[model samples]
Target: MADIHITIHNKTFATATEPTIADFTLSLVSGEFVCLVGASGCGKTTLLNIIADLDYDYDGDIVVGQQHKSPKIGYIFQNPRLLPWRTVRENIELALPDDYAGDVVDNLLDIMQLTPHQHVYADRLSLGMGRRVSIIRAFAVNPELLLMDEPFVSLDPPTARQVRALLLQLWQQRPHTVLFVTHDLREAITLADKLIFLSANPMQIISEVLVAIPRNERNNELAVENFRQQLLNEHPDIKQLL
Candidate 1:
């Protein structure tokens, strides 16, 4: 588990007239599941990239873990991005660090119900199955910080629900500090310990809501809906931000 602190003073592109992120700061406690909710085309994905060290052109300071040292990060994108030539298990094993000890590939594949497909080529697996492989790959690294950007998007309802359950089950066992970005409010409500609402046009956090409902009770649709209703009723203006 790792604590993440991000502060973007001014992030802009050369061709852009204005900054994408300015004077924005957010903190994630170790082992906290925080979700970022915003409209399409917002800088949510960019923020994730910055945190994952995939983009460093931005003017920002990102510190992870207790000693301020670089922490191992696992990132799952919208697409699985797996190698077509690699088998499911191979894809997962490829993510392991050279110095890392122990083999988690088999256990992760078993837990994700991908054992039967472990020998299958990545090109042959369905979207949902490929996504499961990607999830396993991310977790195989035993990351202290995990960043997911709409990992379940474009999936069917049932498949998405199933994947979410599996993801949560693994997360509960490992407790990685996670920052998940989603456009679905209900998905955020279901997965997040804290909900961060963002606004576009220089994306920045506008509101944050704590999910007071217990993790065990979040699976109840009625309870989730009631909590959503209460949130809206309490912060009527937050609706505009969403």
Candidate 2:
């Protein structure tokens, strides 16, 4: 399986002398869905940016598949960053290799349930529809690693729940390694195979929780409620923040 190892001996911003993510080390195996939960200003987004190669000033060793091979890494942000001038299909196609565009775009549109609105421009779609399009666009290139930063934060609870289900279904189907960052504890528990808890400010991993429950059993009402309560009791700070 493909693997990613992130080792941060020390990382401090130029503006601030304090280290943001210190001694942060973790390995993510291919096809595993891991969630990182933390309070605000905990460097969650900063860490993601480093992983995505958007921030290079940090001091650390981030090794993916033994070497940096320009592997495709897809990122889905809180807002759907679709080009307003592009159609849903066009947006998804933009992520595909030029030679594979036509076939890949159609497949993604169907997979994302956007076939009916494939020709619709970004501005014409609803928020949920636009988010779906964004997801499809990210997955179209068959990324080795998928990084998400509170992708469902703006949605209502019910909508977020639906999106969570959709994400799980898609993960099962495509099986890409995922590193999701969120402030929502339930969201982290509901979707992650492994959970990494980060402490407030100058964030560092405080705990790693392995989820033993089968993915198929995650949504079972009784099991979910019981697990939720257990997590709440175990992590009082997290519960209090929520």
The model with the greatest lDDT is 1
Reference-based TM-score of each model:
0.94, 0.93
Q: Clashes in model 2: which pairs?
A: none
Clashes of each: 0, 0
Locate the minimum summed-lDDT window of 10 residues in model 1: 62-71
Global Cα lDDT for candidate 1: 0.86
C-alpha RMSD for every candidate: 1.7, 1.8
Candidate 2 lDDT, tens digit per residue, 20-104?
A: 8888888898788999988777888998888888888877887778885434689998899999999888787777777875766
TM-score between candidate 1 and the true structure: 0.94
**What's the alpha carbon RMSD for model 1?**
1.7
Question: Please, what is the whole-model Cα lDDT of each candidate in the order they appear?
Answer: 0.86, 0.81
RMSD of 2: 1.8
